[model samples]
Target: MTPAFPDPHPTTSTIAEVAICEVGPRDGLQVEDQIIATEDKITFIERLANAGLDTVEATSFVSPKWVPQLADSAEVFAGVRHLKRVHLPVLVPNERGLDRALAAGVESIAVFVSATESFARNNLNTGWQEALAAAERVTSVAQTSGLHVRGYVSMCFGDPWEGRVPIDDVLSVARRLFAAGCSEVSLGDTIGVASAGHVRELLGRFTAEERTRLALHAHDTYGQALANVLAGLDSGIRIFDSAAGGLGGCPFAGSATGNLATEDLVWMLEGMGIRTGVELPSLVEASSWMADLLGRASPSSVVRALSA
Candidate 1:
């Protein structure tokens, strides 16, 4: 049954507003086999901003040899730096990546840390403890430069090789990020095995005040992203990370259906009287445009339904 879409004037509430961080350009395109053009990537980001997503992750400043898709991070940032209404943050993987972001006039940067040893070695090329230390270094240096820093803790729910992950392990990494001066810590369900109860249990360990500084970066690998998001909302989380058109997965992680779709997230949030400040029709259009450019239909249920 297709639920009735929200009215033109949806219900409003003071405490029900949510912020969607669109990650199509950065997290979405980074792992794709198809290398989207620099101009198209810029336009895609601009279209997302026009759709009313105030925060769009532009691109990562990783080495071109490592992530060729976003090799032109500086050019991409230059293209959309004029959008005053939107906040575009680039991912800085290390000190070199941070240097590139600083040169690109980036105002905000995100540093990633791994929660599992396997993922840490694969993604950040170090042990989990060392990866945490590296993240701290990047966070401290980025802070010194007066740039806002957001930290990501990946593999929080489960690991492919290690099976289930412990809550204590995830908590330690998250608290390390907070202590290292990160303004917000995004808990990533990298392989997306998180259930609603698991989401509640994980978040319940944090104080209500701590929840305020947290965001959920969910994946639909197990079709639980939306449910997990609802659970997070119930626990007082305000920020959510998603990609437009459901377009990305980690190249290091062996999962295909990763990244929750921005359209889907906006649809659920707006319909439930939680304002996401995005135009669903416009967002769907943007994702469809990118899907066409990529020569594949979007995997997003909302995008598929609306684009149908």
Candidate 2:
């Protein structure tokens, strides 16, 4: 049984499935003014996993002084044990952060890097080079411990301080992260300014093999996240990052807004006949519960429509 197209891009031909990494507990919660209680955060992750999200980023191991919203990272990790079916990856800022993650017995970890100098200074409190060095060091050490590492390159499309980010700048950081041992690198449209054209151009720079290792983290501020996701699918990208209920943005990047909603992404993927393995009804209910906890309506359009 030979097929017409040996390989089908997720966009045009039928691709089997898309990996949706739910970031509601980590990237989503990090920016909130309302501190979701630690138990609630644990419950949130459990609910997301139970609803069939394969991967859920649990929390970041950074100084609580800087991100007070996730001050209970260790406690949250401790209270909730990892599930056999879920891939729970925690963000570690550096070797020090990595130490905390190791002690918490995490199976996978993620390191984030800024694609611009201004964002490096503001978000990481260090120059881009220095912060990248730390990330590399952390990645190496984590790999040594037999843990999977995912690298995050933020502000890849545009930065609040630097305007449109040069693709070369993103390439420099992305290559370094891969060289340092990241199994996958997620490109972030941090300020939500990137459109389909820009996304295609940036992804075009990679070879087929490199493209296989890439993921898209498109925020929805300009309402182009799903369009960018389609572009990524056209480019053969399989992984996409989203937060439930469109929960959070980068606290350091003020122009940044809610990430692409998991519900929205799920609905779109399933509609496109790309299996996400997520039940929309249960996902919506979970997001609604979290929204109630946060004392607000969900920012996700799909959630709003479905709940209504």
Candidate 3:
């Protein structure tokens, strides 16, 4: 179905092809205090695949001791690997993480590095350079094994520890990821401090060619995620990362809220007459089901309003 959102206005502006990467199972479950059952994870993944998601982050390959919530990564992947036309990407932080993912027969991997030195150390226990190197090595190994790699630059907008992240810092991290052979680099507003103006300003710096390799990962902490997304869309950004039922927060950053919900994103896109290739009702149904499983109210306004 064609989206109601008008096509981009022709004023020397071009809209980049947009793609939504679903991170419900991995990012969403990681922050939940309750451990989601393996079967439930598989079910959630399958529902998302059925809802027409092209890419879904199935789980993280971090050590079970570190992230007990996703300890069933292999089980979830093993259960849902048969789903057709859906790509399951796993998060791998290091060699061990990559090895775990490889053992699970994962063909796509995501590695992340923080834009700020402090955030890098806080999240990965390494500084920016070290974290970048680690991510590069992880991508290298995965590429050698014929796996697709996605790079993540977290805390791209602002940092809790550091006041304002410079544009140069963001670009440097992004360039490193791209040069390291990542298919794309997802820019994360980890703290949710970014505004629409910031989104436009940051995105405006990259050329059309450079922008083609970018994705916006916004959060709704300050209730500005939708605005930020619009700014990104206007700037020709097409790829976004959202969580189902608005599940997920940085465990390391207490001030951050959950991610922008998939239901809300689809609602806005469909309302604007833009096609997301996602079934809104089915996704909303799946969101409701997952929220019930998590035993928490969803942060997605569309889910709440529609379900009501």
Which number leads on TM-score?
1
lDDT of each: 0.90, 0.90, 0.88
- Candidate 2 lDDT over 165-241, as tens digits, reads 99999999999999999999999998899999999999999888999999999999999999999999998899999
Clash number for model 3? 9
| Model 1 segments more than 4 A misplaced | 1-15
The window of 10 residues in a row where model 2 has the poorest summed lDDT is 1-10
lDDT comparing candidate 3 with the true structure: 0.88
By lDDT, the better pick of 1 and 3 is 1
Better of 2 and 3 by TM-score: 2
Task: Tell me the spans in candidate 2 whose CA falls farther than 4 Å from its real position.
Answer: 1-13
lDDT of 3 at 192: 93
Model 3, stretches more than 4 Å misplaced?
1-17
Output the TM-score of candidate 2.
0.95
lDDT of 1 at 204: 97
Question: Which 10 consecutive residues of model 1 have the lowest summed lDDT?
Answer: 1-10
